[model samples]
Target: MKITYLGTSAAEGFPAIFCNCKFCNEARALGGKNIRTRSQSLINDDMLIDFPQDTYHHFLTSNIEGDRIKHLLITHSHSDHLYPEDLVLRYGAFAHNMRQERLNIVAGGNAYDMLSKTEQHGITLLKISPFETIQLGDYRVTALPARHAIGTGALIYVIEGEKNILYAHDTGFLFDEVLEFIAEKRFSFDLISLDCTNVDIPISDEGNHMGLPNIRRLVCRLNEIGAVSASTRIVINHFSHNAAPFYDSLVEAVRSDGFIVSYDTMTIEV
Candidate 1:
């Protein structure tokens, strides 16, 4: 499977929308991979994870085809993850060449209310609950509970295909329940993309988000669970200028620890 990170920023984006902080200024001046948009990813150019407001920008900037996207997995109702307003443009006079297009959007209950209109716009709705496995083409996708917001129906996912991948974002550490499920299923991930919103801030057990410390702890736990191996690829993404400092230093700091810091438009083969 070819996993491409279309965008790699937190809710407000790296350098943010309106900020004059030193970090933001540094990101602006450094340019290149330092500048990031909202978080979004594409698997094999067909399966999409999270449709943010910057989806249009991602489509334009990356090699992904917007029309060929068949399955879309929404993490939550957060606007940075699920932008239903743009789904409205998929049909009617807003878009063209959609006579054979069938976009299957899968999400938790939290986003159902917001995506009700998009369901009627010629898109197939696949409502999936935590632990429920759904098949999309050749891939088996299982939704897992996230450690973030209490009732927002946030989810992390493990996609099993020719190469398995764990796309865990917008959440902190992995829950025990999810780890047990992975163990029970014997799901070993080839590539794992974790949430790194709090890049520099060290957290012992913060519930909402994760930093480098929590990520190290989580990886150690995953090692104990046998979910990850020596050959497994570990990537840290979903950064924020408020926390992550600069691209060059960030790269140097995490590279030695076996963590690949993702930048926008970076693609990984698993």
Candidate 2:
């Protein structure tokens, strides 16, 4: 499977639209991977994860055939992840692709509530729950509860196909239930993308975001449970402007620790 990171920043984006901070200033000056948009990704060009407001930008910049996307897997109801209003463009009257298959949108209850209200045409909504698996084309996907924004029913996904990819973003640490579920299943992932929102924060049991320290802890825990081996590629993404280090410095710091810091338009094959 091929994974493409459409955007790699947190909700407000790196060099946020309305910020004058030094970090944002530097990001703007040193534009490249440092200029990140809201987080989102696409798998095999057909399956999409999260519909951030930057979807159009990704389509144009990445040269992707936006209409070819057949499935959308929403992680939560956050505006950065689930921009339902843009989905209206897929309606028959707006888009001229009637021959294409209907788009299947999968999400948890909270996200579903918002997506379902959108005007539908060639779209299918599937409300998902943690631990339940749904088959879309050749891939089998399962949603895991994310301990973010308490009661939001935020989710992280585990996709199984030619390669297993565990997409864990917008969550600080794995919840006990999710840990137990993975423990019981003994599933090892080929690639695991983790949230690195608090990149510079030293140590704290922060509930909604993760830093390098928390990442180290999670890696140890995953290893202890035999869920990750040396061959498992760990990807760190979903950065926030609050992360103190600049893009280059941050990459240098984390690369040696066995992580692939994702950037916009970055692609990886597994």
Candidate 3:
């Protein structure tokens, strides 16, 4: 399986829209990986994790074929994650060649409500229930509950293919149920893309996002459970502009701890 990191920034994005913070200034000057857009990811060019407002920009920058995407899995209805209005562009009148091909959009209740109100095109909406598994082509995806906004359930996807991956993000620490589920499961993941939004910020407990300490704890637990292989890859992404240690500093920090930090446009094969 091939995974592509489309964007890795939190809601406001790195270097934000406005503000003159030191990190923002540095990110602007450094450019490249330092410049992150809203969070999103593409799997094997056929499935997309989230459709952020930066969808168009992601396509332009990555030179990806948007029409070829057969599945869209939205983690939540947050503006940074689900840009439901963009789906309008895929409708009959706006887009050609999207006629016969089916586009399956998997999301939670809130996301479904948002998509349902919009005009349907060739898209099929699937309301994801916590722990319910859905098969998409060769991948079997299980959506786990994310402890985020009320009524807005974020998803942590367990994607099974040539490699198994836990696409966990947009939320803080794993829920107890999710942890127990994984503990009981025999399957191990080749990759785990986790939320590292508050990498530099210290928190008693992971709330809406994960900090370095929480991430370290999670990693240790995964390792202890043998859920991660020696070659298993762990990547941290979805950074907030408010994170004290900015891009390069954060990368160094994670690297020092022996973990990979995801950047915009970063690709990994599993």
Candidate 4:
């Protein structure tokens, strides 16, 4: 499996929009890995996980063609994750000479309402629920309930093919129900991308987002359940400017744990 971290920042982005904080200033001056866009990932160059508003910029920089994307897995209705209007741009005057097949859009909750609005040509909307597994393009995708966005009943996803990936961003600590479900199914992941929105801040499991400490506890729990082991690659993604004060510090913090601190355009193979 080939995974590309197109953009690795939280909702407001690493430097954040409309902010001139010290971190933002630092990121501006650093102008390298310190800079980040919204959260998004491209898998094997065929499927996309979370279409943030930054998709247009990401596609260009990552050398991804929008028309070539066969499947799109949205985590929720949040504007940062699911930019509905752009999905509409796939057809009609906005796009032409596209691939003949439809783009399968899979999601659940209120995100369905926003997605339902974009039911145009070359777009197939498939609503999914927790624990439901469906074949999406070349992978088996399973939706798992997310602790974030209670109003939308957001989800995190597991996509399995030659390798398995647990894509969990904008999510808090693992829910007991989700953990039990994975445990019962005996699903093992080759790579686990977790939400590090709050970084080192103190946060509880019930919070809408997670910090590194919460992430560590969740990894331990997942390991105990046999879903993760020594060989599993742990990646900390979706960082916030407020949480990840500096890129070098963030990388150094997770160095001991061997967690990959994702950056824009970082590609990994499993």
Give me the candidate number with maximum lDDT.
4
RMSD of each: 1.3, 1.3, 1.5, 1.1
What is the full ranking by TM-score, best candidate first? 4, 2, 1, 3
Candidate 3, pairs of clashing residues: none
Tens digit of per-residue lDDT, candidate 2, span 1-270: 899999999998989889899999998999997899988999998999999999999999999887788889999999889898888888656788554559899999689888888888778899999899999989999999897877888999999989999999889789878888988988898999999988977546557988888888998888888888899989899988888436678789987797988889999998
Model 3 per-residue lDDT at 57:
98
What TM-score fits each model?
0.96, 0.97, 0.95, 0.97
* Clashes (N, CA, C under 3 Å) per candidate: 0, 0, 0, 0
Residue-level error in angstroms, candidate 4, position 156: 0.3
Once fitted onto the true fold, the runs of candidate 4 whose alpha carbons sit more than 4 angstroms away are: none
lDDT of 1 by residue, 1-270 (tens): 899999899889878899888889878888998999999999987899999999999999995567788889999888889888888888779778964388888999688667875546768888899999999988899999998786888998999989999999889888888889999998888999999888878755657778888888888888888999998999999887788556677788888688988989999998
For 25-119, candidate 3 gives per-residue lDDT tens digits of 98898887889999999999888999999999999999988888888898888989988888878766677875337789998868878888987
Poorest lDDT segment (10 consecutive residues) of candidate 4: 84-93
Residue range 137-219, candidate 4, lDDT tens digits: 67999999999988786999999999999999779988899999999999999999999999988889999999889999999
The collision pairs in model 2 are: none
Candidate 1: stretches off by over 4 Å: 117-119
Best of the candidates, TM-score: 4
Worst 10 residues of 3 by lDDT: 91-100
Q: Give the alpha-carbon lDDT of every model.
A: 0.87, 0.87, 0.85, 0.89
Higher-scoring candidate on lDDT, 3 or 4: 4
Better of 2 and 4 by lDDT: 4
Stretches of candidate 3 off by over 4 Å are 244-246
